[model samples]
Target: MGRTVRVIAALGLAVLPGTTAHAAAQAARPPRAVAPALTAPAAPALRRSAWTGTWEAAPSGTAPALPGAAIRNVVHLSTGGNAVRVRLSNRLGTAPLRLGAVTVALRRAAGPDAAPGTLRTATFHGAPTITVAPGRDLLTDPVPLPVRAGADLLVTVHTPDDDGPATFHRQAMQTSYVARSGAGAAQDESGAAYTATTGSWYYVTGVDVRGSATGSVAAFGDSLTDGVGATTDADRRWPDRLAEHLRVRRVGVLNAGISGNRLLRDGTGPSGLSRLDADALDRAGVRVLVVFEGINDIINTPGPTATALTDAYRTLVARAHARGIPVVGVTLTPYRGHRLFDAAREALRQQVNTFIRTGGAFDAVADADAALRDPADPQRLLPGYDQGDHLHFNDTGLLAVADTVGRVLDHRFVGRAAGVRVLR
Candidate 1:
């Protein structure tokens, strides 16, 4: 008789063709298999911390004292974030600066007080008050205040001590409120306490926010970048416009422009070279630099030579590159009709612009000259864009410059944000 064949199936079962005993024996036997070990999922990569400068003004020097008063500064934010911090500068103060209290809030349409229920107090190292030494800057503790892009923020500071010669940004463009001689106005919600208005920003230099932006672009220049001719309280400065344009992307714009600032020597403020660290590289999350200066050095008192200007440009580029920040050079706009402009100055401007355009020293170029120059006379600004003084740009001209810069930055950064970090 043929022996009955039994086969073990892949399902751990024994198949018996003709014997019931085999089936019973297979069913009685225990299976010899072990369960596979499970592993904890790999830890997720740590999220990088990024700080974007939502609003900024280059500190020039001290303004009239705000002795024992509460000052409310209205600032326009370029980008929004989940949290916020304020940067107060005593960079030009001759005495110790005492901040009794500081608060930040979202404004309600040009008003002195913040929007109802949006006020948040700021602290330093967990303290409600802090003192900043002369020539120093202090950053407040992060406040959980969600902000929107292009929103207005009111930063109110109460100084109980005599803040002699208040360190300030002379051309704020936006109006701020001062409670001449009062405290606790910072916590006022009705704006009834604020009585005086001023165009300059005192003590407060920058507003930074914790964000996910790829980086920030520092606009380094002079009066033009400072929005000299732009309409007051309009936020029409070229850098402001550029910041508005960049709202959709992951970038921030910091205007480090000081009126009458020079590139090689001190004038209205510290020279561009001297302040580069504090104004550009040291700013939180700065990844790209836009150099629109040197025009003052070429046209103002003690004007520098074209060679000197270009050499400075080279140095600026080198310095930025050393920090892995790409530098973009903006060609100087025309100034043929200004009192300081002459054939020699115009020639020097052309030479410096040529170097900016073709020198290959900068990572990129923004042809602001071509964008604002009159078609009929390339050496002069277009009448429609000029602010009557050929040296400065009106609202329309500022918009044009902003558009050109936006295009350049968008092309180089928006879609290729990863590449921006890799730029040397």
Candidate 2:
């Protein structure tokens, strides 16, 4: 039974111990010992949350920008911890990228309908000045950033020099910026601070919030997952959309995608098989994972035999399962044109899809093929959803993907809530 206590502020009468006298008994007995005062529990100690998120920028050498394109999409991360670490990327840049200044701050919301709050103040985890070579990424030093989860974390970067096309994602999933008033504006103002000004290269790659070592989700995949053709400044990629979904559910989504990334040999970007440690398996407290990849492996150059590709996928599955993380296999979407389609590629794709769908290795499967494929011609991608390359999905198409996955995930979340399932 639980304990209960009641306090009386003022009582005029008190029952007598022996007789029924009230006033006489009140002045007779010794006063009872006053109880000790209660105090509130202490706040949790400052600690970094294992930050895991991906880079979002428009990659150059693509078609025109889509609707809602911007200079950057700033993601005010849910902060919690003593120190913070930021991951910046030039993964899609064609040349070297430079940074004028970078900073983090406490954000202030302009209004309820507006973005999160503006930066009340900030601190740097490393030198404000840094540079990233083309096709590379940078991780900032562990800076003391005392914050709690659900708090806003503002990051800003400026590029004075850039070369090549200055690689960027088409539509990013998270928010990033190109700088307007240095890197420390009280609020991220509307309108880009920088124009499409000619320069060497500039882009924000990744950011993480570390608060105690726990809970992370790897946003694993290829160009689509990498936000290849999303939009400059506008973080509207599928993975970002997925991240948004996860955010509502209070789950962390770490994007581990590299543009043109394949599950087999190096193709558009890094291969998935080789980057597992750095991408997914290495993060702390990562309890769940989503593997939405293998399209490039099935369709890219120097194509592998069906047997080889099958073997590669099986290996990836085994590796993931070995770590005890529940892996959700996402089917490779339809890619029938834009120059990379072939009979051999089709065979490999089919074999890989078969494995993804039927393989008992995966904890669950996300059928992107069904979501994006044409109902009339299931093998071909649905019209309007395709980015016209037959390889990637447009923003609408990406949203469709997230919606489908979210639909599937809904059941899992509901089951867990109902005590029918458990995620450990």
Which numbered prediction scores highest in lDDT against the true structure?
A: 1
Show the lowest summed lDDT stretch of 10 residues, model 2: 11-20
Query: Clashes in candidate 2: how many?
Result: 45
- Largest TM-score belongs to which candidate? 1
Candidate 2 per-residue lDDT over residues 307-391, each given as its tens digit = 6665655555555555555567788888877687877777777877887787555656788988899898777889878888887
What lDDT does model 2 reach?
A: 0.52
TM-score of each: 0.86, 0.63
Candidate 1's C-alpha runs over 4 A off are 1-49, 416-424
What are the per-residue Cα lDDT tens digits for candidate 1 across 268-288? 877787677667766777767
